[model samples]
Target chain A: MGKRRTGTPTLEEVAAHAGVGRGTVSRVINNAAGVKESTRRTVQQAIEELGYVPNLAARSLAGRRADAVALVLTEPDWRQFAEPFFSEIVRSLGDALVDTGMQLLLTLVRSEGERQRFLEYARGGRVDGILLISVHAGDRLPDMLAEARLPTVLLGRRSGDEYVSYVDADNAGGARTAVAHLLERGRKTIATITGPLDMYAAQSRLRGYQDALALAGLRGTRSLVAEGDFTEESGRRAMAELLERHPEIDGVLAASDTTAVGALHALRAAGRRVPEDVAVIGFDDFPLAQSTKPRLTTVRQPLEEIGRAMVRLLIEEMEEPAVAWRHVILRTELVVRESS
Target chain B: MGKRRTGTPTLEEVAAHAGVGRGTVSRVINNAAGVKESTRRTVQQAIEELGYVPNLAARSLAGRRADAVALVLTEPDWRQFAEPFFSEIVRSLGDALVDTGMQLLLTLVRSEGERQRFLEYARGGRVDGILLISVHAGDRLPDMLAEARLPTVLLGRRSGDEYVSYVDADNAGGARTAVAHLLERGRKTIATITGPLDMYAAQSRLRGYQDALALAGLRGTRSLVAEGDFTEESGRRAMAELLERHPEIDGVLAASDTTAVGALHALRAAGRRVPEDVAVIGFDDFPLAQSTKPRLTTVRQPLEEIGRAMVRLLIEEMEEPAVAWRHVILRTELVVRESS
Candidate 1:
């Protein structure tokens, strides 16, 4: 083997070792798209062999001096701000960004003027990228940001036809597993409380619940479904509405843990014992799930992983404008507790 | 009265009417400090008469290109991130900034490298100002940023000798009220569980506990005290220790709602009935306070208002470097619930 150089390896040396032009090495290092996969692999290998570390400061200076990304939450209801899911995702995102040297700018746009100002600021090249969460259907901000070429990533899609990159938990699969668990427990009358149908996640989860029942040779009718806005109060009201219509629900699949908590309260008020009279399962397995009486059985999504994946995707998109629009859906685990 | 202008009033018109230099008019219009109160009022009256509105875009371009502020949290513990307090404050701050057209960048620094990088970023003029929260004693970041002439406002101070502008809740007064309530209930042996000593809020709460006892002619020794880290688990552990050492303790004051929940759990595990057996009071009336079994009586601090005030103070400092340093302490209310 040749004697190892004492100083940091230069781009020219890496290119020479990989037998490529200096520009090719630069593009590969910067994660620019359009390079052949094999060539990219070769350049990566050369970089690994030489241990070439890109100077982040120099790269940021050459690009834009602002080393910041915006984490925008588009929820109009401020009540949702208290959800444990928000804090969990934010903490995970902060942890993921610790090593990237990029700050997370948290902007909540509840008004049209604020929204317009944010879009203008983002488009003006003040922020390197954006990570938008809690987007509702028919929201134009995501499309506008993407159209402006502002390197945007959504936490979840507005619908199936989302054009921007996003990382989401497998909501449908989680709901399916929740219903299947209830079915295995010999629950004949299964009902579901869904989040607002305007969100794709809620719609997907409702679909999964229906699919699970159908797969089990059970019939799920419209009477067994109630709509919720994912708040505990809504869950309680929906549960109340369901009971008034069909009081024989032996099992329930709530779209979120907060809703499940409300369902638990409503069942207690109705003189029903958990798991014995009505088995209930929730999604998102937040801390409240464990704290709830009888300990709610819920589907645990990899929130931290989702956050890390979002940062990774946003970083990739920012580095290479040509990177394909990617959609990532992580799996969920069913944590069986006494509530189920 | 002068005839109403057909279009937007010019800065020159306001300056001429105010009978001051154009620079002085600009300073007053922008809310910049260092001008006498009388002169400032005169300029403001002139601007109001002319109905002049400074162009934000022009002001941003003429001043610093960046119109963003950093909200820094000093805690290295990720568990603290899940606290409801973080979400509430963040949402409120976002709401306050909605009309300002400025963005909030959240930077969580866990490691030394991340902390150094963030300090350098702020000192390098990448952001216009900073709002710091959860500050611990001897933390150098706030001092460093303030010394570097960056406009800084802290949610709570590191200690009583803090020189920076800050907005705090009446922690000591709240704790005293809690103890007084316990005294009114005829509980003699009142014990206190404190948050981390490094935090000013925690220390003030402890002081309040002692002062209340002293005022009531009840001796409060170190044996009646146990330390917590403002976490549920810490509260549980502290409650367990207090019970072991002073089984006769009849009243408990927890520094935070989360800690109170843990204390309640510990009391239950030990077969102690809430209120009837061992009365408990918690600080920060979070949602968890109401959800806890038998409910938790807590001190309700104006958390949202504190957030808004922090933003307001930071904006003032940013607009006027010579603004006098101000400290604000909002009052807390004693919320009676089943726990007490």
Candidate 2:
């Protein structure tokens, strides 16, 4: 089991340097009781001298590691549950973790107290690794976990300069593709339902929409852009606002499938035919897209692959803590359907 | 903290009985080393004779318990991810666990190896309690958990004779109400699309459909029944088969909203209008019910309440291991809309 570490020092080496038995070194590393204070100090000195960082997989092989990872969702809002994106990502991540023999512990930290408690639990070696999703730009969890020297991975980065390992879909690229397709279809008055601008993904998507309109020599006006929080009702209300501002809008790009469903409903109620009167598209081609009447034409983010990538990256870091941080950007494609 | 147990033996009493210090009793109960072997043996004997179950909440307050719970989903199919039911329940469960400060760990065991590994992990005292969902009749998880004496609560029962504590909705009664509503609307030829019969909930729903028809002096025929696995595709296929067998059928009761959505699609393709040529009713009035074209008139199950109830029961069992097993049956209501 220790042979996997090619360049790393073994527990036996640390024990030898500390002039203690291997079991003593193991107990000290695992923070288990029974080690004498003086002997533990010697082991710590040896570890510092050798710059020893425990190989997570090797520790598990020795039956010291917990062999569990925490998937943390910190959104306090229960309304987020209505969006199927998080659940789908969780299922995919669970499937990816199945063959790895590691259990997935899902932690939802809503308040500062809960966040601090979870951080303490993770720092105390309750879980071997952590996967954070739906993290906000202002969240300190990623930094805290990194500071604790815990092997942590993020589904999406909190900011562009994120130092933590993460995997994210090309939100901007998907939005650009949606807008470009609408332009190609000769839709003169294109509009977009943007998600809350505070979110990095939402901000990037809005940029893409703006860039696409700029390329077509059309200024993306404020009147053509309405804000939505990625819910159906928000989308409906936003669409109504957009129509009142620009009734001639012939193309729509919603930030999410639920929002698109709402846009479709509002358009239908306003007596406009989909694709004929106005072409509509959505992001995240979840099952809701297929179940819609016109069958939503949307950008399909590889959610399952994104989940698998997070697991793979986190495992790599856990196995070799000295590895550098990685940021993977997965591509998204447009799924053409009746609505577009 | 020990003062909370008014009737139960306090740690101080146990320590006195064992002729040891209170700290020694605490160390022994927490399995913290440093106590002499003889002292640990005496504390164990005193605890056994005194029938001390160790107040879990008090233990947690003292920062002794792991303060974590596991939510297990044993369904192997990824298609289950598309169901909004699981997501909503998870949200509610997460909300319920918030004030308790116990983190929720979600485990999806898909294979025999995974199941065995999870059972061992749970039995090893990794998590304080478990909340299981989507378990099948043949699954031994509930029984294994019960045998391990771990505080466990299930979302639904495995069978009629299930000994584990559970919270379930009135599936049969909801089905009967749906059918009776269809009958009141003067639908002469009513058919049913049932979920897989292996699940007790599905069986109960089919029974209710038959009972409703029987009450109106009409015998349910083989041609009027089609089975689905509670998916839209299965629902659509079942509806197609039912239509082929009984083209004159004027009413349909689907076991789930997803299935009913499929039935609506198939009916439309067959040139049949909903509630005119056929009145369709679905169970589980999720958000998808409102998104459909004509909308779905289905049975509204208190999914969030069910989640809270499961959490309440599991916490009770954890706080008092000797408490009697509880079986909570929640009520369901019919939500009328355009479909029926």
Number of the top candidate by DockQ? 1
For candidate 2 chain B, the 10 contiguous residues with the lowest summed lDDT are B55-64
Each candidate's interface RMSD (Å, one decimal) is 7.4, 9.7
Candidate 1 segments whose C-alpha is farther than 4 A from its true place: A1-65, A95-101, A226-250, A257-280, A285-300, A315-326, A331-340, B1-62, B95-101, B181-189, B221-252, B257-305, B308-340
- Over B266-304, each residue of candidate 1 has an lDDT whose tens digit, in order, gives 999899999899999999998778888888999998888
lDDT of 2 by residue, A185-222 (tens): 99999999988777888888888899999998999898
Q: Positional deviation of A247 in candidate 2, in angstroms?
A: 5.7
Q: Tell me the tens digit of each residue's lDDT in model 1 across A1-340.
A: 7996533467788999999998899999768998999999999999989767543333443555357788988888766766777878988898888778677767777778778878866755556889999999978998888776778899989998887999988999999989999999899999999999999999999999999999998888999999998889989999888988988889999999999999999999899899899999999988889999999999998998999999999988888863589789999999999998
Worst 10 residues of 1 chain A by lDDT: A53-62
The digit string of per-residue lDDT tens for model 2 on B1-340 reads: 5546433477788989999898999999878989899889999999989855454334442453457889998888756754777777887898888778677888877778878778767754567799999878998988888876778999888888888999999998999999999999999899999988888889889998999999999898978989999988899999999999999999999999999999999999899998788999999988889999799999998998998899899989988864689899999999999998
Query: Native-contact fraction for each model?
Result: 0.20, 0.21
What are the RMSDs of all candidates, in order? Answer: 11.6, 12.2
